[model samples]
Target: MALNDVEEAHVEDREGNRYFVYEHLAQGSPTVTNPTGKETYRHSLAATTVRPDRKGTPYLYTLNLSCRQDLWDDLQPLFKESIDSYRLVPTTSNYIAPDVRPWQFW
Candidate 1:
């Protein structure tokens, strides 16, 4: 998929429920979070919770992302701002970006 349209979501077992988080990969090969794919994986897990199949309940964390190139240039900063913007209600975390080589992934 294109850079501005690269979205990744993952689910992890934590606590006693399922969590979800996401990340948005931008285009122009701009400096973004390294392992953003995995980064999103963890992020998605942190967002929500998952119920356990056994006697113990499990919390889930989801790392979901939005593929938007408009913030590609300033993914880190924008990510932070976006979190703050959304956290206005109760969330306590935001997004962080690192530099990575896209071509190397291939």
Candidate 2:
């Protein structure tokens, strides 16, 4: 889904790993209605980190969450927990050549 009115900030997880936190409205998403019958856009939150492999090839990892704007506050703890628990698993297989773009997964 496309994101609009984006905002970003640099943050660190509990282990001191840096991540980019993105907050935005999810465009083309169905409207969510609150208890009062007020319709609101879906608010999206994403935390991303980049780490290099043993060969120095960069890999991207991301954790995404979404909820109705009205429930954002209530879900903050859950979101933080998920982000804080994010970790990368080291692997010897599936290594991409340094000359290849990381996004070219096939």
Candidate 3:
């Protein structure tokens, strides 16, 4: 792939652990009948060991991933349903509502 097509970045965590983020897509895009018919996004991130003698600090590891915005939106409902079916949220009989009108003065 050409250098201009990809985006490279790096970030450091609070603990001083640096992470390298590399993002790229397979290609510019596939031709579609309708210009706005499809939309997609892809990216990759990675962390790796840094050289001690290196001028700049380096991350210890790396990661990679790709995404298609339109495709993601279309599949989001199913994903949400799957999570909902998992019963991730607990049911409560007694509800403790937050104070909205005013706070209690001591």
Indicate which candidate wins on lDDT.
2
What ordering of candidates by TM-score runs from best to worst? Answer: 2, 3, 1
TM-score: the better of candidates 1 and 2: 2
- Candidate 3 stretches greater than 4 Å from native: 1-4, 28-42, 45-60, 68-106
lDDT of 1 by residue, 5-41 (tens): 4255565444333345445444333236654343232
Per-residue alpha-carbon lDDT of model 2 for 1-106, expressed as tens digits? 3346685556766455677777777543443344443344567677888878777877677888887776778986888777667765555687654457756744
Q: Model 2: which residue pairs collide?
A: none
- Cα lDDT listed for each candidate: 0.37, 0.67, 0.37
Candidate 1 least-lDDT 10 residues: 38-47
What TM-score would each prediction reach against the true structure?
0.26, 0.57, 0.30
Q: In angstroms, how far off is 99's CA in candidate 1?
A: 42
C-alpha positional error of residue 33 in candidate 1 after TM-score superposition, expressed in Å: 26
Q: Is candidate 1 or candidate 3 better by TM-score?
A: 3
